[model samples]
Target: MVKDVFTNVVANLVTALIFGVSAYIILYIRMSGITQTIRRVIHPKQRVFALHDLKINGINRLEVSKFLSPLSEHERDILVKFHAARNGSNPHNGSSIRLDGISPVSNDKKEYTAHISKVGFFDFIATNLTAYPANAPIRSFRSQMATLMRSFRTFGLIQQVVNEVHKYGEPKKVEDVLENRSLANIISVSVLIVDATGRIGIVERTNKVAVSSGNFGATCAGTVGDVDFDADNPFESCGLREIKEELNLDLERLHFDGIVVPKQKMQPIFLYHASIDQTWEELFPIMEQARDISFETQAFYAVPVEDIIKFASHTRMTDTAAYQVWQYAVKNGQDNNWYKTLLLPFDVKRYLIPWNSQKDGTK
Candidate 1:
């Protein structure tokens, strides 16, 4: 009887050990998946496309419509709490544009019709707050809020919040919404200013800004607000407005370049290139007197076209700014030796889609 009891105890110990090991393995796998999902949402690869490759017709090119995507009760409460904690009152909730879909017009995949809808600024903030990881060092309000909400079990909570947002109104995955262009909560414009001397203008963002604070970004950028809808060229109008507001400089030649959709937030950035007759030295004084300089820009750097790649290597640039530089280099430096360096150290080719084979867009 003694021997039988001892054997039974040994068998129970072995069973418990096996069960514990199995449960640990299961939990680790689940946690690993959650981590990957969160990382993908936080740090997504960017896609860059040229203008001519896309067939954007006159007024019909971008069709805007009214869209009503209200936040859930939980999301509304979270927003309220965040505002109360951060600003002690609700901030300006202006109307912004949201990308609804991009319909492919042809089998060649070169042409697409872009569709957008109007969404409130609050909705934009709520949906896109999870784009940053909890530990992101950026001092922006959104990043801080994300950190506050997901400090505990960061990855799991991020995944849960993303899932909830995705399922709130539409049954879709966060990746699908961002990557597939199913729904982009916000659409903004970024402008690259090139001087007559072939120098690119770069700006350092101030902490007062809502996004990408303390980071280098495009010369000027702003959301495509509701006011742009009435303009003759809404996209260009938005770009020019940002230029006037941020740089206090006007250009007669503002060219629409293309669009870049970054995976991080899946925000569509309408890219513009403006040429100024003045050299960097001549333009500095005017920029200093910009109306919103104290609130928007910390400093401005005039980087030579040839050295942009090297500058990008050293500076912490916003994703849209990096792509804008890359696109500019590809457009002007293809035959130059500096273009080859873009392939070696940075390898931006991995991110930029191949230029349309028919450069002239001729069949």
Candidate 2:
């Protein structure tokens, strides 16, 4: 009787083991199929923020949020004002942020002020280092500047001095070292304007004052501004804002070719391409309405899709991703890649552009 009972127990254990193995095999096969199916869903554009290399640090090492230590007092104030305006507060009215020293009250009271090195102030400029390839068009602009200006040559000398200082200066302030680090963590946005006529608006912008200025390969591109952007309408907001800023077009009637976020930190360049029915003469007056218009040196050119890549390549200031996006559009014909395919749904909110439009259609 004891032998019979023991045999029954062993048989039951064997059956359970076989069932568990079969279930696992079925589940694995289903998961593998699901992954491939997701990949097959292609997207038309890439998400720029998804690819950013954001490194979390011990609170002390957070560099992106630090106050602009390198800028002058006036410049710092301007940034603070910009931040305040974007955040719906008065710049002057805000409490003063004191750095370096702290005020000590009696044991009953404690005051806290944000420091210059803290990662939550104004004056931070985001930059993407990888997009600018050596000997690329951007370098050509630098080369031209080097040749044309005596001041740029002096900058080269200053770089040497900075290197020497780095070799000699002992570690003093951890904040100082962080300030000197030039890792650019900027966000890039592109808008493509397509008119009813299929003619796109392209600008030959030599204006360096524009945020992207000398580094970008394309025109009509800028970083996401200080304004709070909603994820639901990011494409419309960024697209329309760029159109109005760069081309002076009212986007109420325009159709946006959804936002394309890049894969690499700066892999997909922004090409806010718009199609407009208006010619240069008709659209010329709108240029004056721009918030920070830089007409110092700009010439309008309307080139077809076939020639845009070449023009952007020659411009030397266009975003590299712009060329790639245009190329993809041309090669793959519209059904290529979009943000949803390249990115997991959770990441979509961060990179999305908020949509905003004027109800009156006036300035």
Top candidate (lDDT): 1
**TM-score of the candidate numbered 2?**
0.40
Model 1 gets an lDDT of: 0.60
- TM-scores for every candidate against the unseen true structure: 0.66, 0.40
Compute the lDDT of residue 98 as modeled in candidate 2. 15
Model 1 Cα lDDT, one tens digit per residue, 135-170: 114235464445345434344434555665555354
Which whole-number lDDT from 0 to 100 does residue 4 have in model 1? 100
Instruction: Score each candidate by Cα lDDT.
Output: 0.60, 0.37
Note the clash tally of each candidate. Answer: 0, 42
Tens digits of lDDT, candidate 2, 119-218: 2223232111212111112123343333234323334433433353344243333223223332222333565543344434454444343233333333
Model 2 residue 336 CA deviation in Å: 14
Winner by TM-score:
1
